[model samples]
Target: MASTPVDHSAPDTAARSKVERFRANPWLALTAVSFGLLMVQLDGSVVAIANPAIGRDLGASTAELQWVTNSYLIALAASMILGGKLGDRFGRRLYYLVGIGGFVVTSVAIGLVGSIEGVIGFRALQGLAGGILMPNTLGILRAVFPPKRFALAVGIWGMVSAVSTSLGPIIGGLLVEHVDWESVFYLNVPIGLVALVFSAVVLAESKNSGGRQRFDLLGVVLLAAGLVALVFGIVKGETWGWASAGTLGSLALGLALLVVFGLYETRQEHPLLPMRLFRNRSLTTGAVMTLLNFFVMLGGIFFIMLYLQNVRGYTPVEAGVSTLPMSIASLFASPLGSQLTSRLGARVTIPLGLLLSGAGMFGMLSWSVDSSYATMWPPFVAIGLGVGIVLPATAATIIGNAPVRDGGVASGLQSTMLQIGGALGTSVLITVIAGKVGSSLFGELTGAGVPAGVARGLEKAEDAVTMGIAPVSGDMPAQLRAAVVEGSGQAFVNGLHAAVTVTGVLCVLGAAAAAVFVKGRAEEARDMRAQAEAAGEPVGVVAAH
Candidate 1:
């Protein structure tokens, strides 16, 4: 839900009471908030370690292992819009605790299961819980934190979540190495339990009925199914063969469903996502920019993580640490977004952020087998700074521009776009990398001076080098495997360049869109205060679209 300033004494008193309760046992509240977030973050990483083990244990083919991750992400992207709406319609606190509780239970079940099918089923459940928690985590911060400190509170929460997710792969690798993959799932139990208890004690229950309580079930289903179809089409396209009927049908059907969703939403009395929100220039631009922006960042990270571990010959820990520079840069750099808006205005901020991001991606195209980590900082720094600037500036514009009556829908739209965008980005990158690996192996074999007759045996060797198969392929000879590694690593570097090139193109387009859509700051803030006054609500909270 979008944060709105309240003029009501009762609600303000209630907010103060919660704050006072927090001060009395700040650790408890902090623990509750952070742990709830931790479970959400942990799930993002835990599966990386389990991919191989799950494949082996379940007698699954390579396709099944990818499904294990895809199912969760698909559900998350699909359900998040509804999850945010549910929180607004019912209560954010209720959903927060329930979501975490559901997540913990499903995670334990996933770990205890011995079957691949069962694990996929439970992972879907976990994603449902995640969809709930993901949106509400911000809603909780908005409802609990006072107006003056809202930005700082949300910033800290965002920082912690980012750090935890970055650490997930490293932690998962350690647990699988030392104990078992199940330990990663088990790790969430304590954290989940603590969040549940402390949240019950310290966090006050809150909701925004906004004069509507009915669930938009039809709209929800249409949007969700559309996303799943679209994501499946992209994520599984390479593995399934992009030209295959299954892949094309999925994409076509997804497109059709989204069209239906738009048509139906326009007719509904209380649409899950109001079609009218798109009428606002800032809301439309902000949401689109976020979609395109995260598509680059999330996709880049997916490829980069794989490159670091699979191609660059780094351990999980090393990969995690290598990314720390971007993480740090993001924190120190986000407010530049606000500053850009304050000085040159949103028109300038949006385009500037996109240009910065695009330039960063273009710079990353130079990666090679001989690339150094020390040289990696500049591209990462640019991307990080670009993101930091994009999120808040777009957010200020989007929410600042949207109507109060549609705040829930507006918030849901932005978040849903983010989830769907991230899924698409990650899936697209995976698809691109996998496709290139097969071709790269054949090309490498051609270059290696190997005879065509020898490819039957040598192909496995040459292809292993090209396909990034060595991290898990332990039985190969050192010389042969090293050659395979050399070939595969180079292919991945090329994949990075392609992915980065795409990012740069999309970001530049997004920048142009932002320049047209967002409002000037003085006008935006004044509009927000005026809307608050008209609504008989508090001042200084929301800006008008």
Candidate 2:
């Protein structure tokens, strides 16, 4: 019957089939998603390396430079849930595309603007875009991959993140030294373009179709405001004095807003964050552990960069090269963690990861101005291995525990916790370093044999000292200059030692908590199925369309 209607569109038909095949391929979707994820993760690590250059170019103080990183993280942490909710409500593919596009544009703006204030503003914008993109990437994977394969996809996703993070310092160091820091920002353009193209062609749109159409806008506002206030208070406290009324008031307000947000979320029929998800003990513990894990990773990396380049007088490339062990370790550790988690359970894997990380942090206690390469590489490898192991396992636990309908939200929540932990890590650790440096600078300078007058004069540049930069003048006598450098290095190392100690203890405590609280695979799977069944969600494996 259709023989008469055989039109001459064979080539078009073949092209359309090819397009559909590409669109349906899960791996292509992953590849497209990875580009964007790589861009964001790479930017984060690279910028840490570029901070010294940014400060010199823009005349930024230590606090101001901290703002550059803090602003992006805070913005990301605040908006992540909202971004996830929006993707679930709208379409994941659409928002993902928009997010990547916005991120690229904002990155360009950051480079063109050429001012610290402008950089801070654009970095926050870039973060907002990242928040929108990040959770949806996971959501898309959940939608496209069968339930059985989701864990493997997540492992691959974590691997991409590890790789990008590992590459960032080296790429950024090269750009900053050989070219200019702007190149790091500009690097996003090409990767983002590729992502946009592939994602447009390959990703099939998906969303949470089971939910009511209504949104919880108030929850978004409350959460955003609360996170901003908390991060602001922490970042400013370093400069404003923790006892200052501004700091005290900001902290109080933030805590109060977050409390209100929690109470308000429980009342909503369509909450931004479903309070019920926390009912799973494994999920709750995983979220907290994820936070603590990143707190150590991001915070430790930030200071480690400073220590390598500033205190130890390594060039940017040398510093980046030095960190290769950590990056390489993570690259292998991620897949290994996933495999171990599958066999031994998260309860065993996560704490084991944390122990290694904690041990790595403790290793930093031995660091000094004259610390050899031999001294640094071991801790770098340990922390990298630890972070890599925890990342995918915690992600799997958190996302796997949720009802499939809440995939986007769960993904967003996971990313939110990651960013929040990172934000807190960077701000809190820097505060520890700054405060320690401020208090000890005078003694260190004097002890190094600088005259009392010279030492007192140098105290005015405490901001510089905190960054591991000796504020030595060109006109200073050679012997005096050497003393200042020695004193400054000692003071910075003192701060570094203090900061790492705090993080190391926290990591050990987190390991203990994970061991005590996290459920094994079988228990988590049973509870997850039970929860989904009770909620009337399909309790069995769901396949991609």
Candidate 3:
């Protein structure tokens, strides 16, 4: 009888082993996905810094240089939703691998092409790949992580993104200065390789287990066309003039196509993006918050860089170095925001973050051509902390509210908003700066001791002044040159003040919207669980509370 005792411990041991494996799988998946995120973010940030070098080596014109960036933006913004749908329909891991692999290949191709045209074409392809890769990273995370741990995982992901973005200028400057521009593209190879390995080894394949859902071909065409038109208009608005027929026509057509697409989707049995998802207030609010937040963040960064380099005459490396406090603070703030969102809810945390960000922008109103580093660094830290806090909180709020089945689509929507917001921010702020400088240049120049005749002659230099560069020629008298320089700097600072003032106001309004709309943690958890249950996923899968 004693010898016949059952070996029940074997079953218990096996169960423990299974539990341990599942627990660790999420983090491993995070690691795998982050590489793709890192490569994409780093590439985007560094490429802008590398543009001048790219132009010099390839004998590119200004328009050609602009295309180098625009082609990628158009492709990325257009294909993002389609990419997510493809991943949702097929396998996220499959598309993800394909994406990273294509990105790597295209990046290499860009360096080897030896022509600006080829670089532009390859950049488009790279954007398509990025569109595919980005949302799936979130999709994979959404699938693997338990609801309880999702926010923290997303927080880490945000941290990685923020840090990489922050590091891009510095890295690009170093590589372009010391190495060659090609190195920036080649940098992706090793990172991609490691990502491929980890992803292949660790990521479990997941898809919408629906029975052979038909692809929304028409929806794809409409959405892509709509997005392309909209983004093209937004990107070109500053150059084409905001009220020009081209911009107005493109925007109108885009809106019309999107409206048609929405109607078409509502009729589809298995639509690319489920319109029903918008039924969740949290998702809608998160999306709006994402758009507005990036509008301020990216737009603000644009002018700051101009002020630092073009006005204050700092080198690219020095400007990047000055922003280190922001990077460091962001690293800390992301995780903290995640914890706060978990406990106090997005309603509290998002507004708090936005308020802090608004205050930071307001603080920057005091910056001048001769402003000290002490004044500069505090606002940088505040912005870093605020952006870090908002990034994850919004991401978690958006992705956490959706069912696992539609995770990729939701992720894509969020990403599309981000791209559009960034584009709008940069373009609109540029326009604002240019306009403000144009109107104030003559007055500022005359006031700064330049003769009225000379100041009137410099009216044509508003564009240069907007960029923080004075249009003084070396042939000019020393006093005149100094006056021109002083005037130009002041004019640019005035533009900066205008841009930040608008941004600060936007942040305040965005915060109020978030407070009114976003649900608390408990309510959000219940909604998530209910949605998961309706989708027939196990309730325990998202049991946040």
Which number leads on lDDT? 3
Task: List model 2 lDDT by residue over 1-545, tens digit each.
Answer: 55666666998999877876677788888898999899999998999888889999999997789889878978888887888788877888899999999999999999999799999999999989998999988877876776566667777788889778877888998999899989999999999999999899888777665645577888989999998888778767767878899998988998899999989999998898888888888889999988998898888888998898788888877877888898889888888887788788889999999999999999999998898889999999999999999998888888878877677788898998888787778778888998899899999999999999999999998888888999999999999999999999999999999999999999999999999999977887778778878867663232233
Each candidate: RMSD to true structure? 6.8, 3.0, 4.0
- Which segments of model 1 are wrong by more than 4 Å? 1-34, 144-149, 209-213, 334-349, 403-408, 434-443, 448-467, 470-484, 530-536, 539-545
TM-score per model over all chains:
0.84, 0.92, 0.95
Q: Sorted by lDDT, highest first, which candidate order results? A: 3, 2, 1
| TM-score of candidate 3 on Cα atoms, chains taken together | 0.95
| CA-lDDT, candidates in order | 0.70, 0.86, 0.88
Winner on TM-score between 1 and 2 is: 2
The total of clashing pairs for model 2 equals 0
What are the runs in model 2 whose C-alpha is more than 4 Å off? 1-22, 51-67, 114-117, 536-545
Candidate 3 residues 1-545, lDDT tens each? Answer: 46777889999999977855664488888999999999999998889889989999999998899889899988998888788888777888888999999999999999899999999999999999999998988888887788778889888998998889888889988999999999999999999999998888777777777777778888999999999999999988988999999999999999999999999999999898889988999999999888887887778778888899899888878888998998898899998888888888899989998998899999999998789999999989988898899988998888888888788898898888888988899999999989899999999999999999989999898888988999988799999999999998999999999888888898999999999999977888788778877878852242111
Clashing pairs in model 1, backbone N/Cα/C closer than 3 A: 7-538, 400-543, 400-544, 400-545, 401-544, 401-545, 465-484
Error of 3 at 528 (Å): 2.0
Pairs of residues clashing in candidate 3 = none
For candidate 2, give the lDDT of residue 459.
93
Identify the leading candidate in terms of TM-score.
3
Native-vs-model 2 lDDT? Answer: 0.86
Q: Which of candidates 1 and 2 reaches a greater lDDT? A: 2
Give lDDT tens digits, candidate 1, residues 1-545. Answer: 99999679998899977776663342344456778877787678667766877787779887677778888888887877787777667776688888899999998998899888888898899888888877766655545443344444444554555556656777887887788877888888888998888788776655653564567877888998998898888777756778899999999999999999999999888778777767666678788887876787677777777777767778766776787777776666555565555566667777887888888889888778668976787888887777767765665555445444344445556667777677778766666665565556545543543335533454454334333444325786666556655555666666566667777888888887677667666666676677667667553232111
